[model samples]
Target: MKTVIRYPILFRAHPGRTEKPKDVLVPYLHEHDVPEISEAETHIAFRSQKYALVEYDGRLFSKVGKPGSNSAEACFGHAFEKEELRRRPWWIPTIEGDKVYIRYAGQPLDNLAYYRLYLDGGDKARETMIWPALTPDYQRHLGGPRSRNEFTFQGLVDKIRDINGVQFDAGREEHRAEAERLIVIDGSYWIETTPPAICVAHEGRMIVELSHLPNWLDHDLGRQYFPLTAKDEAIEYARRAQAITQRSEEPVRNFADWTDFRFDDNPLFAFDYEGYSLKRTTFLLGGDIARAMTGNGEIEGKIGSARARAVLSAKEGARSCGADYRTWPDASDLVHDVTDAWKMTGRKPGWTEIPPKRHEFGTMICERAAQMADSMPISVSARSTWTTSP
Candidate 1:
């Protein structure tokens, strides 16, 4: 679904005024050929970088650039460094492949150069970072020094309120007003510019917010409401109803600690490099049991499949899969046969013990069962000294 969002262009200065420096179009406004798009929610802290935020599917994206046609690399390079892009984690999905461009409109070389860049719709997956020109009004409100000579932060806050029709509450501090204005204002602006023809709620209900709004690109409002992001200023509205719906449904589950595990602690590493399995670590042995067993000597292969099954079936079940055992046949041949049987049964022989087959209960089964029955719980001390012996 394509959702366009628009904001009023606040010129840094009223165009045609002689006193101020000529409206200097910054790199964000000038360098891009295509209208760069941003997701607003992901871009909540955008002022840190001179960019506008757009929200797509509850996630935020930012679009930064100047006016009138240039390679995306040059525009992005001027504002951000290569290292910075590399360092940005989920906040900024890395920009990969090709320089995309879009032609800009509302070009008046003279006094009217003070507009915010307009974001045009483009394929997001291919072009992760973008630069788009804005209307002069948006430029005025963002509050940065205009022209290289005298760039002071002014007019940004007022412009935001004015552009979005947000009423300032006298009860709050000015900074609070500023923040609310920016968030709500940008959200409202985006909704107006990209007025969605159809909005699907989180519960799967589809809503048509506008029957039709004037489309600035083709100048047609006959089909549905003008998307909030169109270049048109007259038809902008914030559609935060969808956002509300999304938050309301899910009971906030905070598994943040485990979900946000870092590179060094990725449990997958414990499984692939070492022999620890997730079932054995997270739930079975409390937490991070693999790390607990870091330096023990050849403890892994010493326990045979039957011993493993017996240990797992204990009251503690598979939680004790890493336990120590006494009296095991040389696992060289046994391990292979057990592993083969495991594949056929699609079960980890170390974790489950099935009844012996007819004629199979002779010596092998008895010995295996005896060893497993004798296995002991892996001690915390043993785990701390765990190791792999060649």
Candidate 2:
């Protein structure tokens, strides 16, 4: 199993006026900022001094107790129950907008756009998403609203208990306004928290998944087909991709060749070789590279899966899902289970246009009809032995 890396980090709340409830930006502190967190919880003096928030996979805790209040002193009071955690919807509020900061929803996000999704401007309250998990202590620390029954939580505790707390008090605008942003969502954030073993897709679209703290040091399952930046890490990926262009032979110049790397006009890429060991094909932009699969211009442009070659669909869907078939077979069961869940819950559970793991081959065979030259050597189609996967 690939280990998910965790940063030894802390969140320190910036001091501001406490008169009215408002959002405060919390800065990320390196481990050295609070060296005590590195040791055993029982060994460290948790309440020695009111410490900053310690974070892991999103669930947080502090080192101090509330003054003159009848409350649990620290994290020891909370229950570590997946039983309950699996029931509540997990949400990541948009960073910035000066309203909320930092977000990490459970993996396999329903929409790819929401993986790193952000909200702009800090004016409106409706733009921000709310989670009931905000404890009074955390809210006070965060300088956010103190309604534990915020968002869908009120519906969970009050509305169902025959208490109309969600209703307006004498047509109070405040009450009605809060209700508007309170989006009621079902199913827990859990269902699937761990990243999939291999990239899995449902039908044609790729399934978007996330992992804890996807930074430069971490394995970012959440960031796929985004872009290869000029950062040091990206250069490594660019190296491997460039190597493909200089592979067994240079790509045919006169026609589009599948056996060789085909660069595209606008490229969307991912740095996945580190974990997946899959071949990274660089899609360069060239007029010859855009030739139709059929020798005859019977079909106007690249059709079927070929249509996915250069743009968003290919990187986000194909490479993101590990169509290269280089997954660690020992743990292939995880991929199977994730795919099954995706299919059963997908838009078309009955759809069968897609075949087995070799799904790409058949489609390519029919769509691909490219070669070097007509009178010379045979046009090398990407033909492979037909095999079935268990």
Candidate 3:
């Protein structure tokens, strides 16, 4: 809900004034210059001591006092020409045509103050007098005969009432709501669930439902995906894979050997001594080895010798797979072949169609894990499976 208040004031060329009036610029009044309004039962008790009017260039100009003073120096002629006035510190003097008719137009309630002063005890007729004080000049600037109702005290009162009514109606319309929903959770920012949900806070109150949240949050949260393993664990696997690959044996000796290796019925894939199979061992031991190597920025102890050799063999196998895929015309067929290779080992397919780059492959695995995590139970045992070390 929003609310706006408007204060509209129209200054008519006083009464018999001539040329088109210029805009009035009111300078800011100092604290001491303003008089305090006392609360009254029927009407507010405001006085006119804070204001003063002086004649300047055949026109009347009004000024408000500076904080502590009840009277302010006149803002025209030789006094206005002074260095202090040139600074134009607080208030902007009002000018209408060549005549300076009013000052303090920028101040809040300046016009109202004058109205109240006139009603109380000030000379209403004298205050109403206009500049260029002639009927002929008034006709030239005003364009037509002036109506009795125009620029009258009653007119100002009516304008105030009209503005107040408009603001009140606007405020009411803004707050009118179609439906209401109360939040059950106080501080929860997000919720874990299928088609996951999030909470929004407005004015210290949480909104749980999707429709009630802000537009930006709604759009971003909709596209968000959580991975199974934590991001750090995925990154660790990539680093280990990279390190192992760097130290592995080079590719086959020549094209004939590579072709013979590819077409042979009894494919002789490289295997380390333990015979657990390099790819299987790499998939299983990569996480644990990485953890031990980088645990506290140093290698804690000897990595299991057998596991290290198997990791090296896995890197060799990955290099072989990459070479084989490059010779194949169809990429999809390569993916199928890799899947078959894993199946032959009685394990899940861990490598992609193209040889997986360590970092990208690790990220893919983590994202897959996160998606899977969304459906599993919240129990600790179930959660541990996502990043369980071999």
- TM agreement with the true structure for every prediction: 0.15, 0.19, 0.13
lDDT of 2 by residue, 15-59 (tens): 232332222111111111111222233121111112222322222
Q: On residues 112-156, what C-alpha lDDT tens digit does candidate 3 reach at each position?
A: 222222222222232243322212336646574242112222333
- Among all windows of ten consecutive residues in candidate 2, which has the lowest summed lDDT? 1-10
RMSD (CA, Å), each prediction: 27.7, 21.2, 35.5
Score candidate 3 by lDDT.
0.23
Model 3 stretches astray by more than 4 angstroms:
1-153, 156-164, 167-390
- Which prediction has more favorable TM-score, 1 or 3? 1
Which stretches of candidate 1 lie above 4 Å from their native place?
A: 1-96, 100-150, 153-390
Per-residue lDDT over 50-129 for candidate 1, one digit per residue giving the tens place of the 0 to 100 score: 22334444423223233222522232223222222211111211123212221111111111111011111111221122
Comparison by lDDT, 1 against 2, better one:
1
Please name the candidate that would achieve the greatest TM-score relative to the true structure: 2
Badly placed stretches (over 4 Å) of model 2 are: 1-149, 154-233, 236-390
